[model samples]
Target: MYNKSHAQMPMDRSPPFSSSSSDSSQFSSTSSSPAKSMRVVLSIECLKGSSKADEWTGDMLQTGDIVEELRIGNMIVKSPFKNGKSGIQKILHGSFKQKETSIRVRVRRGCADLAELQACIVPGDQFVGRKQYVLRAIDDPNYAVGFIDRTESQCLDLQASRTSRMVSALERTPLQDGYVSYPWERRLVEMLSIPNSSSFYSVLFLPKSSDKASARYNDLEDTLARAHTWINASQASGVPIVFMNIQTESLLTKISGDTASSTVNAGSLSDLSNIANTSLYGFEDYHGVDLGVVRAVRLWFSPLAGEIPIEIRIKDTDTRLGFAISRTPEGFIYISSVIEGADDVPSARSGLSSLYKQASQSARLLVVSRISNQKLLPWMVSATGAIRCFDTVSLSQKLSLHRHTRVPILVHVYLWDRSANNANVGSIRARAMSTSPPTPPSTEAHLKMTARGVEEGEEDSDEEETVASDGQEDITIERDTAGEFSFRLHDFALKNNWV
Candidate 1:
């Protein structure tokens, strides 16, 4: 169990432990009794994937030890150190305690701008408070063992909970789907959520330390209101939602002052000793939670990963072809690498490489722009009610409810070539619209002919429809009229010729 006196505990003892509260602002705290028979066995692993991993064994760790992050081995290495002055760390053996190196200082090392820093802390802080130290399932889709930070932040203490109101509210929060609200107590969740090649790091909430309190109850409530609205909207659509405090992953962008080094070079021995310091910008104390939740939802539904194209097939309500999908900011849900694959698929099989050759081998993926008789990319927002993105629920529901010999799923695909510098950056496909049937004209030349036909007294018998464009992919003109045209993708190359 954690205590106010936990700071007074010594290292070299043992861990009954667990642990990010954002902010250099004082972390919030409240203690409870941990379970007698714990399900989560927690420990801290330092310098994972680096030489330091060997040095900082999980068993030797204790609470309050000063730890710094070193970028090494394409990872964030958490190694133990002493503050410039002495610090507190506790170590509790399985059934005993051991003496640890603890020293008290007389003259405090003070900050230069104490007044400015003091203004950062807020009193009566209820909403955006302290960090969460334990994670478990209300119910989970993936195996719980995979996401737990078992090696490092593995177990709950005698009792540990979120110190802030916002943090606690989210802990163990349930979705209609029966999963916990958030499981990101550590980087392990990030690794599982994203591709294996990606690395995870915790963002410091309230990155700045302030002795002075500055939170207004009204403003904090307003922020919560916005987050709540989004959560309700997303839940109605069957996507699990959460309150994200620290943002750990983002699109890797290159900035002038902080150029990311080569993964191999950054992990070198020389670089290991000289770790990069987190800049002030890296320590942003964001006031609102809406943007973070929005990005998280966007990621939850995204399919593309590191520019590689992935394919997904909706087989049933609970069954899928592969990979967790996400919507691009452009509104199209592009496929990413496979996160999961069904053991039994009824689709026509072809070697992936052979399918690639259909597009001259430049294409690495096929994006599903349409499903059955419905479009994934919307042509128009329903003025009557809420906006829909990729009739996602409708697609799954169709598979679950409908009967078919083989589930005639028509998936429209576009080639995603990864060799280009601008990956998923902008609009990559072109379109020409038509309201008539027969062969659904494919060019401006055909559009001209259709217009000319109407002018020349030709009878346009087939019902007319509209397919809007994102200036990228084509629209569906045959969903209702032709009973979902068989989406046989004979061509996979992009019109851009990157193919």
Candidate 2:
């Protein structure tokens, strides 16, 4: 994945370079040439529609570079490839093929036509899904833009043209409070969304929430063009736009959840972060593809719900407690993991492990509800009908309390078993829950395997033999990949046949 943060080009006049590649040199000699000629013909994950890498012809000539000609359909576009960019290319150049001429690319600012387009989409302008823009004509408002999607052709080419006229465009779209796609912009998303019959197309970045969806469609000059008057991205609002050229294979894997097809070696959701890079991934189908089947992204990566507050008396700080804490986006704070060696700590010896049985083995993350007298955010029910939220800034002061200085602190952890049972009995309404008092924390040192609180139709896994145990044969458990769990567990059980 050729990763580079993209920035939208500023509004300006005159296209970055002349339309003709003929003016470019077959050899590099910019010092004597006047035209700064180049064209980036690579697929941008966010800009191109096809979930595959694409290439096109470029006029940027350089010395000692191998430029292969790609014959796609009737188009003989030069494949814009560079040797130094790929390790395999280096190997080939040094040993096998012996082609010293390696390609070098200078990625210009994103959006080559920022100056002429003048970044202006007035009210009532619509985008059709296929890169077509239907807006007021620059020359005459009555005569709408017949066609604006053609790149190899003129800016105003039509199936029927009254006259050959050049329409001057705005320099910039002017970044405003309203959402706007940078680098590829909204236009490029549509362009990519348009079907590619000749070759595959790739985008620069992962599309924002509604990147594939267009509000409107137009069929001017008999060409399909997607048009959206409004900007896309409800989840990306206020988030800075970062232009990145991720691998096309990566986007497909995350979008389709197909690990076998992924080229970036993305085994987990964290690995695909460079693509969507947002926290709004619902543990469901990405786009329309169910993640359960493809098994591309790890679902249980971030499980924090709210601020979790834990209080413990100062024990010896040198013992190196195995317990670790993590956060979730939902606002639930919980004990993420408890190291096995934590039993050596003074507090664990006294009874902390008793309070955290399965938690020690990473069986489950224990949710913390309160610390001593103070209740953690949202978890506490108050008569004022208010849910206290955690302020990391102020709360960190208490969490950072010196172990050697502080006395024993009462830690109130939410027992998952009790929570499940309570929910099973009947879920408490927010109104009633707001007035409830904290439940007495359970302090059992060795909870049973049944204490895991498995839901109906799901049995306890601990009853089955561990993979390391004797008389255990590993079996595959078919499961939904998009579910809370990303991978299927290898069930090790006693081999028995009773039909």
Candidate 3:
């Protein structure tokens, strides 16, 4: 996982390199785009299993790195790759094998034409998952990606065309807003029904994390892209967007700073000061929107004072980061999870019960708990109104249910016996494994696993146990990766008129 912060790129900037073959006759056109040119720097995790340290001396080249065969001081050196991956082999298996190894690559930027470079190297299955170094395109200094190990810093330049095209997609997506709520589905639907109610809506955005920075999926990019789409669509449709800007406290530092503060504000995203400098959601030049910082507000905070609208607050209660969509006499509302919390289903349900009582008088509620916990099933049936209960055993099953429900759902995972510190990533992994199919080994499995391991925990690990930093077995119940846990819970709430 290569993690980077969210900094909006300017609009319509020309691609740093010429796409024309005449200008770039030397480099092959196989690879194009900023993401393609990124030289994914291998990290300590990448070399974790190596029996001996591997070395690189520009051993390979990205197919897209080709430029005119250079007469560098009258020495003709040819490039050996195309499009970053092994393009010569049409066999899919060959490509998978190439990505499993760690190899260095250098992408040449100027002098057009890759014919001379391609002519020298025999194309085959050698460069599959080989580590690549993309030198900065001459056009844009900021455009470069590769394995940047502390021991060795190698890179390859790319065409300006790659940068322009890659960054173009990023520019179109502007950050908007994010949200979260408790477990009560009815409460979420009711709160989300309020229109243009800012105070009740707490904007949620993903903060940059150390794990996130090194993450492979670029969650910030994905998050920002989502925000952009949501804001654009909602604004065009006249739906108000409530965004939450919550700060994440580093457990490591807080322990050293003051153990007392750590315990007082340990698990929740209550602290607003720990946010990274670049973790804000804003465009480079957009000036129309005011309020420089998105607020760290939650709908739960409103009922205490009774200032914000109750409908918006209801929507904000998305426990398990579930999803919800409601159509009431008031208006249409979409409820979704913007961030996740450390609470379990039982605790979340309690908070939600209180919130629902505040938001509406005749609100109905729907709930979903792990089917494995048969004891908890009856408690759900005891809830107010016609509570619809689903017997879902895993998160993936919850997603399957979501495909059919347009309303929000509440998903609960119980780690009642687990501690917080140990509850780290293992909990999320358990949720994913419980819902999805196990991956079968393939030729590319080594590279793919190593790549994922470098940034995130392995999906297939023997140990299902997780311990919190405080030596507590952190127990967590969450929605599956598909986000259906939330959706299903909310849908039940609306269909049964929980709110």
Candidate 4:
């Protein structure tokens, strides 16, 4: 129906149109053109205690405008203020307020040049790279429709592809019955097989238990190795790794010198110094790892374990029983048993402090199990802090995201509490880990230092030589930090450099 010239003419401008008509034409041109279709990402960070939700609006926003959403990314409010759910809905409603200034917004366009896009741009770069701009009504009457532009950064999730490598390589079968259903794990596996181009965040869970048999010691070596491999790969590729420690249970079962089912309540581990430090009956072979670190481990009670004298689990406001959540330096959050009934507020507060210490500090992986009650909802939010949640397929999907988009993939351990029968508690929870990523080059330097020490062990102590990958030993040797054992390996490698 249109003329041939109409199709060939420039699309952004109006031809012989009035001012109002021209404005409509401009809006239509911008909305329909492929040049306005840019990919964007959004992230949220440190969102806690039911604060205000970040909103995005304006019909003029292109595809690539929203890049990242983080807890403490560029876009953040200086103070902690309460926000309602309507904020996000407001964005959907295209309610970019040009009047009451309260929120901040940032927007930016993607690089047009192919080289710049490929050499430095990333999947979430169009959004994450720039500093967040405030959404003030004063800055242009179109404040609500304004876009903030910022710089791009290297995301860990867009660079990994071996999310399933650990799962596929493992020879052990999953615990059929005793194990809690960690949907996070399942989600990670699924995501690894099917990749995405975005930031990946997830958690691994360690169920609460005083029983070492349920500790999965057999899988310990494999699990630890898997974490190492994933962390190593992530570090090599600029991804961050958060590892959570195991949680301990406070509910004890008094044994009648019988089967595993027979038990009693011994009490909470919070009073370990007062508990007589008595050797636990079934825990004779148990090492001090579980009960040692209060920050990394949490405790809870189990109905299946029978009843005992002392009860350590906390009772929530709803009387559904609660437990404390804590963290370790390796990014693991330890969970405790729940306290049901009432009147034990003292123990609950103490346990809560410990849980908060971990949550507020380092934990990245969180566990969700059988405990039920809405009173502990605030606690759950506190534990998550600045972390993200994902299904079992998250890990894999994260790997794929990293591979395709150059984002970092965060690793989390997740567990579900069977004690929680309520449906509203959600499927997964997470905490950040106490992890210190080591530089590969530093590791190599240490290895070389160790090798030199090993070589020195065999040489004439008075006249030793430190040489590179050469046969001639012409360099003088110096020992600063490492001992003789370190040099022994170097001498051995030097002797067999060809191999």
Best by lDDT: 2
- Give per-residue CA lDDT, model 3, range 136-169, as digits (tens): 2222222222222211112232333444534553
Model 4 lDDT per residue over 19-46, tens place: 1101122223333434333312242221
User: Cα lDDT of model 3 overall?
Assistant: 0.26
Candidate 2 positional error at 405, Å:
1.0
User: How close to the true structure is residue 132 of candidate 2, measured as C-alpha lDDT?
Assistant: 29
For model 1, residues 99-129, the per-residue Cα lDDT tens digits are 2111111100011100000000111113212
Q: Which candidate number maximizes TM-score?
A: 2
* Regions of candidate 1 where Cα sits further than 4 Å from its true position: 1-326, 336-344, 347-366, 381-388, 401-405, 419-499
lDDT of each: 0.25, 0.27, 0.26, 0.26
Q: What's the residue-level lDDT of 98 in candidate 3?
A: 54
* TM-score, predicted candidate 3 vs. hidden true structure: 0.16
TM-score of each: 0.18, 0.21, 0.16, 0.16
| Model 2 C-alpha lDDT per residue in residues 339-368, reported as the tens digit of each score | 455466533654545555644333334655
Residue 492 miss distance in model 3 (angstroms): 13
Question: Distance from true position, residue 396, model 3, in Å?
Answer: 22
What's the lDDT for candidate 2? 0.27
